[model samples]
Target: MAIRAAGEHKQRITINIAIDGLRLRDEKTGDCLYHHPVHKISFIAQDMIDSRAFGYIFGSPDTGRRFFGIKTDKAASQVKCREIDM
Candidate 1:
């Protein structure tokens, strides 16, 4: 855990993500199927003591599959604002 004071935000949290491509394989032939890119995100609290989550995202970026997507007025109103639990 790395801690740096940003000033005026005590319990501020940060989310770090890494996006990489993984090869998919076929079951019968054991051949490469396709390259799938996934996003892995990690959450860290400002205190640097308690960490929150480790999640993976595999979906369309424009539509924002499942847990993540663009937040617009329509989307925001449709979705509730709360802590994400997985």
Candidate 2:
């Protein structure tokens, strides 16, 4: 997944994910933005151990927030700052 701003002056990011690796590239020039290795986990036998774990924990598919981060607590503060700047 990637996101781009509207204008040429703006920057864009392109992210690629794989089983054992992840890479991010710049959309405009096809430059390597970032690269990282990921650990692969297999849950094939996990289903046999606990069938109930395969189902959703919260019952609702959309119950959780779309974005999560250490900076999530500062979201309101950041919005307030932007509002003041406006």
Candidate 3:
């Protein structure tokens, strides 16, 4: 396997981002307890933009969970840093 850094890649990296609202239910009661929203962001390396996914970030569904902002910020930064300056 060949390893290439983001800056060394010939093409620009492409990222895929998705957000959705989900209805979570209890297994026993099957009752709709709460509505949760989730965000998923994945990175495709510049070299293998279509062949495979380079990395991914799965955001927490609950905002009350600590470090949510930190995680999201980190993911965003990673994506921004992957871009090659024009």
Candidate 4:
């Protein structure tokens, strides 16, 4: 599923569970947003991005953190089932 937040600037993110690991991509330009091999992620942070929504903050500590602005449980479950830290 794509990321959506009401009253916010437009962004396109699609989450996928690949054989190698978790993948986040941009649908409009065919760019990979974030990708991590299974068991390589350092942490998963659950927090509010703004007043409008809450999502995940995940990445290896050495690489810094990245955000995935997911809006629903179903979307989160999709990521979790793939062996993500969250």
lDDT of 2 by residue, 13-80 (tens): 55455554445578788898655443321111112343322211111244432221111222234322
- Of the candidates shown, which would achieve the greatest lDDT relative to the real structure? 4
Write candidate 3's Cα lDDT for 5-84 as tens digits: 44463322223322453343454566665443443332223223322223333344563332111112123444334332
**Ten consecutive residues with minimal summed lDDT in candidate 2?**
65-74
Model 1, position 83: C-alpha lDDT score: 19
lDDT of 1: 0.33
Best by TM-score: 4
**Candidate 1: pairs in clash:** none
Whole-model lDDT values for every prediction: 0.33, 0.35, 0.33, 0.57
What is residue 23's positional error in candidate 2, in angstroms? Answer: 0.6
All-Cα superposition RMSD per candidate: 16.4, 19.2, 14.8, 6.1
Tens-digit lDDT track of model 4 for 1-86: 43234556466576676667777788788799778675665444334343333355566678777665554434344445445433
- Give each model a TM-score: 0.25, 0.33, 0.21, 0.50
lDDT of 1 by residue, 1-86 (tens): 22344445223222221245444344456566444343322221121222222223455657554432222223232122221222
lDDT over C-alpha atoms for residue 19 of model 1? 40
Model 4 residue 47 CA deviation in Å: 8.5
Q: Where is model 3 more than 4 Å wrong at Cα?
A: 1-20, 38-86
* Residue pairs with backbone atoms closer than 3 Å in model 3 (clashes): none
